[model samples]
Target: MEASKVIHAIYNDDDVLMHAVKKVKAAKHHIEEIYTPFPVHGLDKAMGLAPTRLAICAFMYGCVGLTVAILMMNFIMIEDWPQDIGGKPSFSYLENMPAFVPIMFELTVFFAAHLMVITFYLRSKMWPFKKAENPDPRTTDDHFLMEIPVHGNQQELHDLLAQTGAVEINVVDKAH
Candidate 1:
């Protein structure tokens, strides 16, 4: 059971929103979340959020995909089947490599793209087969939302949010 103060603001311009957020931060209030219809360039820095690690994950997943492609192809073509169907040289890694390339490439691309997407989705809390927990339906459209958790001193918090130019304010109690 906890309580949080939330502010909802509608801004057509990202610059205005950035200015408001910077003011709120300068007043030392904790921002729980910010919702927008589109990405705002400087919003992350303004909100004090750490940079995303998705690129590192993508690189690792791509390496894994390459490894999987190589291993599966090598195991099937060399050890398991050892086929000489085209009258090519026997046990030739180089000659048969060209033929297996399409499948290998397909597997590599499939694994890399799919895994990387999944990783990003999961990291961003957008994983498949999971329900979306959108706080408001209107946030998906024209409105921009800024939610702040009131860390201390309720009156001070309210005054600060007011000074930051919040269009609408709400205090929600999660405890039943």
Candidate 2:
């Protein structure tokens, strides 16, 4: 494999990072990635990334959970073994629907929360025991880092990053 060079520009403030991203995009340089301590609003739009579909996925998962709850409740209470409880006969699912509402709601939220987290982890390629890919530890604390691949214009890219309020810039050779 060949080793490629990449520029890591460290920024202190999120605002500076956002402006730097816009300037870099306007200059036609492809930004590989950006890391921040917390979610930066409008960063995705500035990076020209597509909107995330996690919300839609969570909705679907919730629907599945609701269906499961309904089917399970029907089988257990109505079909499998019907019994009278609290003066209400479990002969019909519709009659006992009110009693099942808590279970349905709980299962829906549970599935949506757990499955959405799993989906996010899988989509991000973050498997269990995976090595950390963060280039700088400070990004996890209070700093922001922008990574851009060098395309034989190191000097130009370095000068531009410096002009964009980067606190520090380093060119590192990355082996892939």
* Highest TM-score model number: 2
Local accuracy of candidate 1 as per-residue lDDT tens digits, 1-176? 55445544445456777988898888777777888888889899999999888777767777787788878878887878887776875495676888877877787678778988887777778855887665667678866777766545667766766666666666654321
In terms of lDDT, the best-performing candidate is: 2
Once model 1 is optimally superposed onto the true structure by TM-score, how far is the C-alpha of residue 68 displaced, in angstroms? 1.4
Q: After superposition, how far is residue 89 of candidate 2 from its true place, in Å?
A: 0.6
TM-score, per-candidate, Cα-based: 0.78, 0.96
lDDT of 2 by residue, 26-108 (tens): 99999999999999999999999999899999999999999999999999999999989989998799988989999999999
**Which residue pairs show backbone clashes in model 2?**
none
Question: Relative to the unseen true structure, what is the C-alpha lDDT of residue 159 in candidate 2, on a scale of 0 to 100?
Answer: 99
Task: Tell me how candidate 1 scores on lDDT.
Answer: 0.73
